[model samples]
Target: MPKEKRPRIKNEDQYEALRDQGYSKEKSARIANTPDQVASKKGGKAPAYEEWTVKELYEKAREIGLSGISKLRKKELIERLRNH
Candidate 1:
């Protein structure tokens, strides 16, 4: 038989582990494909999403390239940011 083809996963072990932990395939793949340097880096000093104004939240969503966010309210923006 021909060799089985597999996706180009940067971290196959991490992908398998994430899949076993019930993470969605896309989510698992995205996380597993992240570069080691980026993965180990810490987040910025931004405050909690809850404390951000609606405009700030909208701007943040745009900054992160999140789609369909113009219609989302403050609470929805918070949820989207947290889940993102």
Candidate 2:
């Protein structure tokens, strides 16, 4: 029998699942290392980004301190928000 190697991440299963879902390594590690109780309760209360107007998205980007949003179209803004 071979010994199983443990990862440094707090939740190996969650990390692997996130990776499989296409999340970046940094994002996966951050989410997996978060406490289960806190992570489960974490989520946005806002509506879907697609429903938001370009102006609304721009304001949100500004609020979040994102740069180079002044010239972004609605879809680009939405993509930026989701990736950010």
Candidate 3:
């Protein structure tokens, strides 16, 4: 018989490994399929959250789908983003 084939999943090896390590299917797929493998990589050139302006933080929170952030103070926004 021909060798079994996976259905062309991007980063299939990583996905399988994540599954072996007990990640949920959806979470595994998201991490594996992220174009740059950001889950396993870190410390890019972006400034720390504390250095960002309140407006910038709010926008980032909005982009990340964080709720109750519209009226949050800068420190609160930072904490919320970190907690999420």
TM-scores for all candidates: the values are 0.60, 0.55, 0.53
What is the C-alpha lDDT profile of model 1 across 1-84, one tens digit per residue? 985576788888999999899886778889999998988999879888888889999988889778998888799889987776
Q: Candidate 3 — number of clashing residue pairs?
A: 0
Model 3 residue 37 CA deviation (Å) reads: 7.1
All candidates in order of TM-score, best leading? 1, 2, 3
Q: Which stretches in model 2 have alpha-carbon errors above 4 Å? A: 1-34
- Residue 39, candidate 1: how far off, in angstroms? 5.3
lDDT of each candidate versus the true structure: 0.86, 0.85, 0.83
Clashing pairs in 2: none
Off by over 4 Å in 1: 1-8, 17-27, 33-44
* After superposition, candidate 3 runs with Cα above 4 Å error: 1-40
Superposed Cα deviation of residue 51, candidate 2 (Å): 0.7
The digit string of per-residue lDDT tens for model 2 on 1-84 reads: 874564479888999999899997877888899997887885779889988888888999999878998888899889888787
TM-score winner, 1 or 3: 1
